[model samples]
Target: MFQKILIANRGEIALRVLRACKELGIQTVVVHSTADADAMHVRLADESVCIGPPPSRDSYLNIHQIVAACEITGADAVHPGYGFLSENAKFADILAAHNITFIGPSGDHIRIMGDKIEAKRTAKRLGIPVVPGSDGAVTDEKEAKRIAGEIGYPVIIKASAGGGGRGMKVALTEEDLEIALQTARSEAGAAFGDDAVYIEKYLQKPRHIEVQVFGDGFGRGVHFGERDCSLQRRHQKVWEEANSPALNAEERSRIGGICARAIADLGYSGAGTIEFLYENGEFYFIEMNTRLQVEHPVTEAITGIDLVHEQIRVASGGGLSVKQEDIKFNGHAIECRINAEDPRTFTPSPGTITHFHTPGGLGIRVDSGVYSGYKIPPYYDSLIGKLIVHGRNRVECMMRLRRALDEFVVDGIKTTLPLFRDLVGNADIANGDYDIHWLEKYLAKEE
Candidate 1:
């Protein structure tokens, strides 16, 4: 086991990793920007280092400063808690060269799965079903048109290296294809420094489902089941639930087994998620997240597995602690991303939190990084916390979630709490009759 681990991120995830390290008798070193001087993670860590100013490029994303901090603190391993450089292949390679372990997959695996085009091809080779699209990236508008026509109308153009719905466009007709292709290419180039784009036949009302898989470097892996992240806005997940109400035992087992076998075949280590779009009882591979996901708590709640502990153990050459058949899934869990944003307008809300009180009870958990007086800085993501709850079933879980939401209190800033409150009372949300486009349409109806 590593004596000390450096956390290369901030907010709730940083604190999450710190707690895991403490439980395993591992010291934690937290690196933070100037804006996060009063951050909760820094306060709890065994050691803290100020890397740079508020800007992410100069601070959280600065590789040299983070590596230097690791060297100074004698941290033998780095746990990048999502975002920033968590999925960067170059960052992983640099840590390897320095003889420091990155608590995730190898640089090669990250590189292969980071690119959407290559990832789809790899999934296809592994016999994982993917959405019908061009065989590879389409360089010109003519090729894009040809591919779109072949795939049929209502196709979507996506960036080869895109995420968060930034570099995507949909064309409902041939006349819209030219503009969609040009816009997607331009956005992709600007965001990822790659002008490459791919085409896919867009499926209407598809549910966003993802399977969580863990692997030991020695070719052992297990699946913890699936999470339904269909409730999204602008491609960002707003709410997530484990053991999706959409799938039965047979479907869940089959998909979970496929994911685990795929991970083991790839010789992947640590934690990763394989995302798929479900429409009409069919699952189509969308993409793979090469690092821990923000919605991982729901999975943990149902499985009772300390994913961070497993990650560290895998990096330290310890094989998987649990086998495939030994794993058991219990109950239903839900996670609501508590963000500092206007519920109605979805605008960022950054200010001092005057009053704060988290809800607590049986099966209710709040993973937060803010306090009563912590000022939410505009320089980062709006997410301030996650409210998770578990119960015997979906109905019980929804009731607990509603009760917990009513108890959660935050003042001096706008939050999406109102939206959740409304959602809990809605017939569609309560009945699990929602999809990727449901939230947007719901919000539109509200307007």
Candidate 2:
């Protein structure tokens, strides 16, 4: 086990990793930007270092400063919680070269799975079902048109290296294809420094379901279960639940087993998620996240597994402790992402939090990084906290989530709490009758 671990990120995920390290008797060194010097993670860590200014390019994303902090704190391992450099293959390689363990998958796997096109190919080769799309990146408008025609109308153009809905466009007709191809290429180049784009048939109203898999990098792995992240806005997940309400027993078993086998065959290590789009009782691979996902808590709530602890253990050369047969899924869990934004307009809200109170009760958990008097900077993502609840079933879970939302309070700044409060009582949300575009359309109606 590592004596000390450096957390190379900020916000709740940083604190999440810190708490995990403490439980395992491992000291933590948190690196923060000047904007986050008073952040909760920094205050709670065993040691804290200022990396750079508020800008992410100079701060949270600065590799040299983070590496230097690790060297100064004598941290033998680094846990990049979720964002920033978590999925960066070069970052993992750099840590390995320094003889510091990265609590994640190998660089090779990251590189292969990070690209959207490559990930689809890999999934198809592993016998995992994938969406019908171009064989590779479509470089020109002519090729894009050819691929889109072959896939039929209503196709989506996506950046080969994109995420979070960036560098993506949908074309419903031939005329739309030219504009979509050009715009997607430009956005992809601007966002990821690669204009490469791929085409796929866009399935209408598909549910976003993802399977959580863990491996030991030796052709051994296990699947915990699946999370229903179909509740999304602008490609960002707003709400997530474990053991999707849509899948039956047979569908769950077959898909879960397929994910486990694929991961084991690929010799993947640590924690990763294989995402799929489900429509009409068919699952098509969308992409793979090679790092811990933002919605991982729902999975943990049902499985009772400390994914971070397992990540550290496997990265330290330990094999998986649980097998596919030994794993058991229980109950249902739901997570609501609380962000610093206007409930009506969804505009960013960055200011001092005058009064903050979190809900507490049986099976309710709040993972946050803010406190009363904490100033939320506008330099990063709007997400400030996540409220999670578990219950014997989905109905009970929704009831608890409603109660929890009513109890949550934050003053002196806007929050999305109001939005959730309204959502929890909606008949559609209560019945779990929603797809990926459901939230967007609901919000549109409200507007």
As for model 2, its CA RMSD to the true structure in angstroms is 0.9
Candidate 2 positional error at 318, Å: 1.4
For residues 56-82, could you state the per-residue lDDT of candidate 1 as single tens digits?
999999999999999999999999999
Candidate No. with top lDDT: 1
Cα-lDDT of candidate 1: 0.94
RMSD of each: 0.8, 0.9
* lDDT by residue (tens digit), candidate 2, 47-135: 99999999999988998898999999999999999989999999999999998999999999999999898899999999899999998
TM-score of each: 0.99, 0.99
- Candidate 2 off by > 4 Å: none
User: Residue 258, candidate 1: how far off, in angstroms?
Assistant: 0.9
Which parts of model 1 have CA positions greater than 4 angstroms off? Answer: none
Q: Clash pairs of candidate 2?
A: none
